[model samples]
Target: MSLDFVNTYSQLINLSADADPSTFYSTEDYRKLQTLGPSLPTLSYPFPSAEANLVGESTIDVKLKSIRPPFKFTTELKAIPGSLSIYKLKNQLIDEVVSLKEAGICASNLKFMIKSKILTDTTTIGLLGDEVSITVMITQPSHNDTSKLLSDPEPELEAPKSISKGAWDKIESVLSADLGPEAAKIAVSKFKQVSI
Candidate 1:
């Protein structure tokens, strides 16, 4: 089943001309909405290990250092997989972050961009090989005359805003009810990451 209710409720936010979202809304409603949405972050045919198949963590942090025009943005990800080109990941991450920012989900338009390179030494000599991955994140504002458009608080006025905290839980239930266990598990994990 789709997260029709959540989507529907979102559509009716501020009481639009659509269906009665209040009828489907609850303190735990946003969670329910996510439940009706699509499945994300799936593991392929053969199971992919969180280790080997797992690419190192890549994080993009945008810091709004000042409240002026031409603001600064810093994005940095440590322990990223060198095999993956930094430009590709940077571009993709920038796109996604910019989309979220434009959608008004992120805090502010003022942002800072920071980048870091890391190397991990791994050995597979014994019967079993062990891999350890570490991720580090840093935050700082920009240091220049800034003029960036801050995101409007339109999302705050939406019904989804009130239920965002419980959105993932409701979404998990919806997914479990619709998709199989494997898919639900993957979705739940993805949801948790976003929830954080």
Candidate 2:
């Protein structure tokens, strides 16, 4: 027979509401299973070996270069299965990098590039090469995204100034010919008329 436990101890409804929302009980349960802490006592299993599931596919050494804010690091060669997609690789990286996991960086926020060519999530490991350097830019994460804002955006009090105004003033402005006699003057006269 399945055991059905009922709340017997009398507790005020207001007490639960004040502590957290209705989902608090469920969320707290999952918190113990979160792999980030790998949640203590519930140790996470080691990542699968890179050699798994190889048929004709070849493995590659990926050198991750975190180039953007929130986190930046030297290129580190990480091992992975050739069949792993950029999508899966991102999650794998998150699992491996403490800073990335702490920052709550997700796959969508990561922009990957190689030789100036942008890489999509569908991109696979073996397709890159036996060795490759992939640059990453993080969009930033906040509680699974706890990174806080250092400051607010500066408010603009005035419209942006344009530099093209002087060049567009064809009546003897900077764009007009001056020192060289060969080039005709656009305005024909440099003299300024004083207003009375």
Highest-lDDT candidate: 2
- The digit string of per-residue lDDT tens for model 2 on 129-161 reads 888788888886544312333355457687445
Per-candidate TM vs. native? Answer: 0.17, 0.43
Query: lDDT for every model?
Result: 0.43, 0.64
Question: For all the candidates, what are their Cα RMSDs to the real structure?
Answer: 33.0, 20.3
lDDT of 1 by residue, 1-196 (tens): 3597567656656453444668576767555554433334445577657786445534332222222333234344333343444334433344544533443322222222323223222311121112222222222333342333244333445334233647767777789899976798798887677653
What TM-score should be assigned to candidate 2?
0.43
Question: Who wins the TM-score comparison?
Answer: 2
Regions of model 1 farther than 4 Å from truth: 1-71, 99-196
What is the TM-score (0 to 1) of candidate 1?
Answer: 0.17
